[model samples]
Target chain A: MNAIEINNLVKIYKTGTRAVKGVNLTVAKGDFFALLGANGAGKTTIISILIGLVNKTSGSVKIFNYDIDRQFDQAKRIMGVVPQEFNFHMFEKVQDIVATQAGFYGIDRVTALTNSEEVLKKVGLWEKRSSIARTLSGGLKRRLMIARALVHKPEILILDEPTAGVDVQLRFGMWDYLRELNAGGVTILLTTHYLEEVQQMCRHAAILKEGEIVRLDSVKNLNKLIQQETYVITVRNMQPLDGIQSYAPVVIDEHTLEVNLNRDEQLNDLLIKLIQNGFAVTDVHPKEHRLERLFLSLL
Target chain B: MNSQWIAFQTLVRKEVARILRIWTQTLLPPLVTQTLYFIIFGKFIGSQVGPIHGISYMSFLVPGLVMMAVINSAYSNVVSSFFGAKFQRNIEEMLVAPMHEWVIVAGYICTGIMRGIVVGILVFLVSCFFTHPAIDHIGIVIMFIILTAAVFSLAGLINGIFAKNFDEVAMFQNFILVPLIYLGGIFYSILKLPVFWQNVSKLNPLLYMVNGFRFGFFGFCDVSVIFSAGLLIFLTLVLWQVNIWLLKNGIGIKN
Candidate 1:
């Protein structure tokens, strides 16, 4: 069964702002899926609704086959969330905070304490167990968020910008841990501003623009967001390479030239031109579609 | 079955510990403030001002001072803790959890009550150094204090829900709380007011709490103790429901 199914979801704020406009999505159980969007793109709003924090104006949300709006408590049972904001009791000790969250999920203090210890150690917070939450560094706080989200052993996990303020090295480490979690059969949904994160981690993806789902498909399908292709070529000799007219080669310098491709375009035309021009071609390379181009397209 | 209960207990304990950690700010400040009232209006001024209702003015003012401290601290605890949650944005964890929303609210109110009662006890201890105000019924005074704390804590929950920013919270405490407190028969009995003003003062909810608390001390009050307890219970229930709705609907929070 799909971990989360959002069908024609519509959300209108009480102030009359229509934030989400009929978004439909189905995230398969255990798949690492990325919800991509720009600011004000309704990504966070959508996540909030699924977690039961925001009420939907209309439509349905089903988590693990249970409609969240109709069966809130049961749907919430299987879901865990890591919010983008660092929202926790700052003055409280880390040990108390994590254990309290476990207790909410019905874990006893004894078990909660043991589990909290293991988890805090997992996030490198065991040494600072008694430290106030506010005194933790930004990176440590992010790790703390991860530990809290996982305290209940939820079947489905949602991370909202989990690596936003983290250092470059820690970001990679977090992604690695999440990858391990995903491999362990927990369905994971992530909303991120970093495109490369999506490229590396997600198997399926969606894009939202101005509160509308502009794209939704497998990771490979998202590559289609960029249509035109680019190819770069290097030659053994530099000569009058202008004859490569059919492939539209632009001679960038003495050794390098570039060509843009369409579906019907053939590379033979450029090879024939370069051979005829006495420019011995040594290498021909095609540049794959990049997220930067896709982002620019969405904008 | 007991999971959520444990969660609730932990939340309450954490909240209580937070206030206890800052005992000076949370407990001592009210005592100091109330002592000023004892020195100025109770002893220094009571000597010049004749007896009030056949009792020393100092004895009469003690109940009012105690109730006021209870009301203010009770309301302040909830408003500040919840608003601090709103400010630091930590409340999101509880909101998104699998736990019930009512549990979160109850835990918060419990924290408020603890602060209110702690300060009340401190004020009582401080008052001992002044006039030895006789307690006609210890049970009745404790009951009145609990009811007063409950009602005002619920009111503070409402304020926390509706307050949009820190400035708005300050505005509520300053404009609404301070005026209502002064006009609630704290320093003077409503009996001294003109008939029209006396009738109006009776309608002020704080009047019942203060008068009932006074009944606990001197066994004399403007109204029946039963009536005061009843009024406080009614206010507590009404404000409790309103607070629940405000929190459930995210009135000013999510917006």
Candidate 2:
């Protein structure tokens, strides 16, 4: 069964604005799905509709085969949502937030407490469990949200911009934990502006533009649409390669040389040319992320 | 069903804890204000006004003051707390959860009722320092107190659901609730009013609640116990249904 399924979903604001216009999408069970969109592209409206925070104008939404309109409680029981905004009581203690969320799922106090501790420890917030949420930093708050979402042991985790303001270290740590959760058979649906994270984490992706899915495919298939890959080669020392126009290399500062090569171009040929030109290459890496190129192309 | 109970308890606990944590704002102000009313209205002013209905002026004022505190606390508790949740957007957490709409409304109203009763007890205790209020019908007093709290709490929930700002909440308390309570005959019996004013006082729903509560304390009221009890019950049922409808429709919570 699909973890989530939306058929012709539409949302029209009272102000006569059509936020979402008949969007149809699906995420399979145990799959890591990415819903990519720019700001005001109706991503949040979709999430809100599924979670009962926003009323849908038209369409059907089913979670784990339960209709959202008719079986909301059953649908919600198996799903956890991390909304884009921080929607927690700021004055509440860290431990209380997670446990209260578990209680909302009808979990008993003993189980809620146990789950809270487990999730807090996993998020590296056990030491600050008794502290008020307002005292935590932004990254810690994001982690707290993740911990709360996980406390109920939901089968489907829907994260909307989960790491929007998190630092690089915390972002990677969260990514690792999410990957571990997915590996453990949790279906994950994520929306994020960072295309690199989508490339690394999601197997299937759908790109929404102006309330419509303009592109949908596997990450590998999306990457196949890229006609060329840009490579940034780091040289051993600072050197001026101003006359190297044949490769159209952009000499960035002293040690970096960026070159764009088509799909048919050979890496060895570029390396041999650089060697013959008396330039020492220390390392070479793709400059543009695979998902980033595909994302731009679709937009 | 068990889960629904658990969720309800959690919401109630959170609401009560928040109010208790800010006791100076929630508990202290009402107690202090009621004490002043006891001193100024019952002691100093009552000495000049003398007795009405064959009871001391101080005793006549106790039940009304207690009910006044009950009304204020119950109304403010729900309005501020619910609006605080909306302003902070924390209400979305409950909205996105699996709990029933009735559970959410009941949890908030339960908190309001709890605060109302607590404040009523405190005000009554303050009144005790000045006068011994006769308990003509303890059961009637308890019933009216609970019903008054429920009615105002439901009204507050409706106001909170519609309020878009803190100013709107204050407007509800000031422009609507305060005038209704004052004109409800908390200070003087409606019998003291001129004929036309007496009829006008009857239009204020709060008059029935206060008179019903006074009947419980002194066994005397401008209105019959049956009329007061009937009106209170009818209003409670209507307000409850209105609150439930608001929650289901997501009037002020959802876009």
Candidate 3:
């Protein structure tokens, strides 16, 4: 069963601002699902709805076969959220912060404390457990958020912009930790601006534009959409176009030339043709489609 | 009494800790500021006016100071906490939680009340520095202080919900609260006012809180404290409903 199911979810603000038009998505259990979009895109809104924060205007949200409306408690039980913003008590200690989140899941104080310690260690913040939440650095604060979210051991974890301002090293560290958790059977719903992170971490992805789900597919399938592989060649000279008949039509701009190739094109043949034409190929590199370019093209 | 109550309690604890963690700012500053009002106005100004009802001028001024502490701290706690949540964009955590909307409002409100009462009690204790403290009815005094804290806290939460920037909270504090607290007959009895001004003072809802609290100390009041308590309670329920509606509708949280 899918860990979380959202169908045509819509949210319209009171001031009549339609934040999320309608989004439909399904995240299979234990799958790492990436929800990708720009700043004003409906990623946060959709995440908020799944976590039961923002009330949906229309549409059904189901978690574990329990509808959010009829079985809100059941749905809430299995969902853990790491909000994009700092949500911990600023004056609270790291341990207390994680413990409080556990308490929200009906965990007793003793177990919550034990769980907090274990999760804090998992995030490498165990040494800073006694430190106040506001006193920690930005990256540490984000890690603390992650630890707190996992304290309850929820079946599904939702992270909204989990790595927004963290340093590169810390970002990868978080991704590693999240991947480990996913391997342990925890479903993860990640919303992030860094497309590379999605490509590296998530196997399933949903692209949202202006509150609508423009595309949702397996990471492999999405990558397959750009069927023609790309290659950029910086030749010594741009001879007459007829000299290179083997290569597909090339787009030329300044010193660089880019060509689109069919999936079955032989790389060796193309390279040999360029070499024999009296033009030295300074650089010949195959380029895979980037999520950013695909995203821009969709927009 | 598990998740909902526990979450509410955790939020309240966070709120209280935020204020008490920095007692110099939360509890002490307001106490010191209220003392200046007592020294400058009650001691110096009242010596010339003489006692109002066998009560020393400083004694009469204590209730007003305590009420001021309650109202100011209560309002500031909710206004600042809610606005801080908004400013930091942290309210999304609670907004996205499985917990219901009212729990969030109540949690913030309780924190406001705790801060207000703590500051109010501190001011009440500090009043002893100037004059002998008197409590004609201990129960009434406790009830008055608690009810005052709850009412003002709810009002402050409402303000926090509607506030967009730091200035909006300040606008309510500067324009609405200051005038209301002053005209509420904090310094003098409402009956002492000229007939026209007495009716005008009656229009300020804060007058009931101040007068009701004063009656708690002296057992003497111009307005009915029961009516005041009931009215304040009604306003609190109304604000609570409104706050929950605002949250559920994503009035400010969305975007």
Compare the candidates by TM-score and give the number of the best one.
2
Q: Is candidate 2 or candidate 3 better by DockQ?
A: 2
Query: Each predicted complex: what DockQ?
Result: 0.56, 0.81, 0.36
The local lDDT score (0 to 100) that residue A161 gets in candidate 1 is 92
* Best prediction by lDDT: 2
lDDT of 1 by residue, A128-238 (tens): 999998999999989888888888888899999999988999999898889988999989999998988988888998888888988788887777656677888899777
* Model 2 residue pairs with clashes: none
Query: 1 or 3, which is superior by DockQ?
Result: 1
**What's the best-to-worst order under TM-score?**
2, 1, 3
- TM-scores vs. true structure, each candidate: 0.90, 0.97, 0.87
Q: B1-255 in candidate 3: lDDT tens per residue? A: 577887787677667767867878778889789989988987888788767666777888888889999999988888888988887776755654566777888888888888888888888888888888788988878877877788888888878888899999899899989988988888888777789988888888888888888888888877998998888788777877888888766676664
Residue B221 of candidate 3: its Cα lDDT?
78
**Per-residue alpha-carbon lDDT of model 1 for B1-255, expressed as tens digits?**
575687687678767877888777788888889999999988898789877799888878888898899999999888887888788876777777666767777888888887888788888878888878899988889988998998888878778877768887788889988888899998898898899999999878888889899888888888888998888888878887887787777675664
Show where candidate 2 strays beyond 4 Å: A237-245
Per-residue CA lDDT of model 2 for A146-222, tens digit only, reads 99999999999989999999999999999999999999999999999999999989999999988889998998898
The fraction of correct interface contacts reproduced by each prediction comes to: 0.60, 0.83, 0.38
